[model samples]
Target: MTKGSVRSANGRPHSTTGGRPPGRPAHADPSTTGGQMTTGTTATTPTGPAPLRRPQWVRVLLVMLRALLVQSLWFWVWVLVPAAVAIVLLDRFGDLDMSVVQFARYGGIWYPFALSFIGVGIQFTVHVANGLTRRSYIRAVLVTTLLIGLAYAVLMTAAMVVERAVYTANGWAPYTSGHSASLVAGAGSLFAATALAFTAGGVSGLLVGIAFYRGGALRGFLALPLTVSPAVVVMLLTDDVAAGRDWTFPATVSTVPLTAALCLALIAAAATAFHLLARSAPVSKGLATS
Candidate 1:
């Protein structure tokens, strides 16, 4: 009937307001189009900054431990594979006088000793630069040192046991190069000696690491006896329960338990000394000023 108007179905013309009610605005919300609320839009709840989380030393220790293990994978591969081959070849052809397992013992010690230096020399600066506290890094390293030493001890002991079996099967003697006659008499004794020695090496590494880090080359050199004494003493003690070759302590007093206790005490002392040195050690200007 009229422009912009539509007729109802009953044959009567009803005006249309362009499909919108006359009183409603053109840009009115669609939710109120029919006097009813629609679920057409979503509301976002405001969020605050993520809650601060304290740094976890356990996590740091695990991460550092894994990194150390991965980094040393090549070392173990090189050492174990070649050493195994050499043992077989030497036994097959050469008249070997001593056990080849002894090499692994010394290697187990020296490798951890060397690794300790890197743990502090590089990791300390890296941790500091990354906003980690020195105390946290030190604690992680200390725990990692113990764990790695134990791991090496288990590996070395297992190798020794396997070697002993092979030697026995071939009618060869698995004679250790240590001064103590009973060092390799039993698997338990062998493991104890290995664990004690390796742990001592790790702790000694920390001592020397902090020493060199805190002091320059000259000072570190000067402090060698003090810093390195723990490892040396433990190694010597493990080698020979007696200070004198002619004089030996009574078997009851020179038990592995006593030896372990003494070695643990020495390791604790070295670790304590390292903590003291590291606490006061200044961060190198080249690494991290703060």
Candidate 2:
């Protein structure tokens, strides 16, 4: 019956405390909140080393690997859909001469190169926003880039095996020969080149993304030629790849003066530039200074 008192069920007035009760959580535990039942998470986002914590590299690797798998799956589908359409059309009209291995090989180079932005453009922003260091994120991305490149190459080689069998079964021998660096190796050299090309693409993509992150759309556009140069160098390393493909290199690259060493050097240069630019990159709403 008091002004600020509440009546109990038994009809007795109880005085109000005017404060929250004890032994109650103000917010849910982060781990249990979103179904993330992680243990020993002392804080909302775990920072440095903890006795019960997993290694940062391990966590970073997992995030990178998961992203790679997701991207690679969709990428393979994109690669295969066009390939399937082309195969059907070519086989139907007897234009199977347009090699499937060669067609798919281009994807191995281009997808990773273009998708490399996901590393810095998307993942980096999220991770950095979540309190990760740029240095650690870049290192993890490099590792992921290497892995994705290797994965792209390996998948390419496997697809080639299928192409070879199917093409030969269809009485297509000309395209079946595939690319050999020399008389002894057709698949070996192809695999290595595929891996290298894919790797170059991934790193180049990463650098392109870094440029945009640091400088915005205008800078990204300006960096396009420099970013694409590595893939060009890789393509021109030998006559094995892009020899019979519809795509052509820049007219400035008059001759195939590039070598394996030079191609590697270009990839290394792009990767190094990305590292230098990104090592101290700041997360901001406005464009960064490169």
Candidate 3:
């Protein structure tokens, strides 16, 4: 075809320039760094197994389930062995008085510590890439976190029950009436505290992961105070190690119920922050790709 010819000599053009006609508007489809045209529109590609068979929300739920599974595996593989070893060692070798319930009481805080940093950030990137809205991803994460908290609470309560049975059979004392006044009492308190703290930690973790993923080091460090505030609130409510070792408002709200309420409120705030961060979530480069 001639340079200015509208039609080729044989009445057909030979060059295929990505479906674009010659002299097309530059603004219509700008060139990417890789020379690909931007679609500039949404494309719905379902994710998860059997994408054609399941609804999109069900896929979201499946992703949430996977998230829960990963968290549970981390708990059992990474957190459990060390915890059991420490419990046994402390009970036998260390002279300090101890109970398994005390360790179980603090298990909720570790959930966020495990999930909030590197893992969830990568998950956010993947979920977005796989055609999930940031809104949906955050919601799934929150739901999954709640389930993790509830499952751990149930597990801890069952462990307490078994511990009580063994202690009763062996004629040994477990704990003498503090937060855990009796075995049943301990289970109730631990279950409630664990569930609350786990949910709060999950929320805090979402905030931390999103912050670090978006802002790298500077914003992540700046977000520390806000991102960790939910866990701090949980610590304030449940931990009685020292009065002033960490931030606490026990002077104004000393009761467990009040403290729990405060923690939930903080978790809600963290969730809001998470939504804000994830709405504009960006894909990041990683070693795996390089």
lDDT of residue 251 for candidate 1 = 57
177-243: candidate 3 lDDT, tens digit per residue: 3333244334566567667777777778778888888888898999899888887677657554211
Q: Could you give me the TM-score of model 2 versus the true structure? A: 0.68
Candidate 2 clashing pairs, residues 3+ apart or interchain: 113-201
User: Which stretches of candidate 2 lie above 4 Å from their native place?
Assistant: 1-54, 81-85, 176-185, 242-258, 286-290
User: Residue 135 error for model 2, in Å?
Assistant: 1.5
Ordered list by TM-score, greatest first? 1, 2, 3
> Candidate 1, clashing residue pairs?
none
List where candidate 3 sits over 4 angstroms from the true fold: 1-55, 70-74, 77-96, 104-107, 176-186, 240-254, 285-290
lDDT of 1 at 70: 78
Better of 2 and 3 by TM-score: 2
Alpha-carbon TM-score of each model against the true structure: 0.74, 0.68, 0.65
Q: Which predicted model would earn the best TM-score?
A: 1
- Candidate 2 on 12-120: residue-level lDDT in tens? 6665866433443355467675865444534676677877866676689887798679778998888877877878787888756645556676677777777787557
Sliding window of 10 residues with minimal summed lDDT for model 3: 240-249
C-alpha lDDT (0 to 100) for residue 234 of candidate 3:
78
